[model samples]
Target: MLFVDFTPPAPCVGDLNNDGVINTADLAQFLGQFGQTVAPGTGADLTGDGVVNTADLALFLGRFGQSC
Candidate 1:
């Protein structure tokens, strides 16, 4: 049998939503998932506070589209 990893990759520190880079797209993505629980291994936890809550979303939005 073959095994495949199902864990979501880490989000780029600047890539708030983990879509790829820090931009409006990321901001939109974060907003879409706002108030939702990010699964384990998902990099939605921008603040690294433990869970992907509104705080993290806020942080992401705050830096939305800002350069690294």
Candidate 2:
């Protein structure tokens, strides 16, 4: 017999609201650390344009909290 343990991993993004998924909420958390250089990740890829920058931040904020 083989035994397997199943457990969900911790969220890589911080979306405290837990609205079925993480996106801008997580980005909002990142923005708090803006103007300070830091490593990049999914939340930083706001516009999905293959880079992180002010434009992505603006796009994220512009459409925050609106379900698709």
Candidate 3:
């Protein structure tokens, strides 16, 4: 038997709520911050442009349902 320790990356993208999963909750949070300049650490702005817009939403949607 072999047991190798593996650590996942920190702060997975698309995980707005930091719940380790990208789902409706993240989508809801994104929608809530849509068209607004959210803070840098909010994670709602997928594009990292300080603002949550269609482009960011599109990017987020592409990664929907993915697990961190």
Put down candidate 1 lDDT per residue, 1-68, tens digits, no spaces.
Answer: 99999988754564754456688776676667666666643556676555777778677777666664
The Cα RMSD of model 2 versus the native structure comes to 6.6
Among the numbered candidates, top TM-score falls to: 3
TM of each candidate vs. truth: 0.52, 0.38, 0.77
Q: How would you order the candidates by lDDT, starting with the best?
A: 3, 1, 2
Leading candidate by lDDT: 3
Report how far residue 36 has shifted in candidate 3, in Å.
Answer: 0.4
Clashes of 1: 0
lDDT of 3 by residue, 30-52 (tens): 88888888775466887777888
For each candidate in the order shown, give its overall lDDT on alpha carbons: 0.65, 0.55, 0.83
Residue 64 deviation, candidate 1, in Å? 1.7
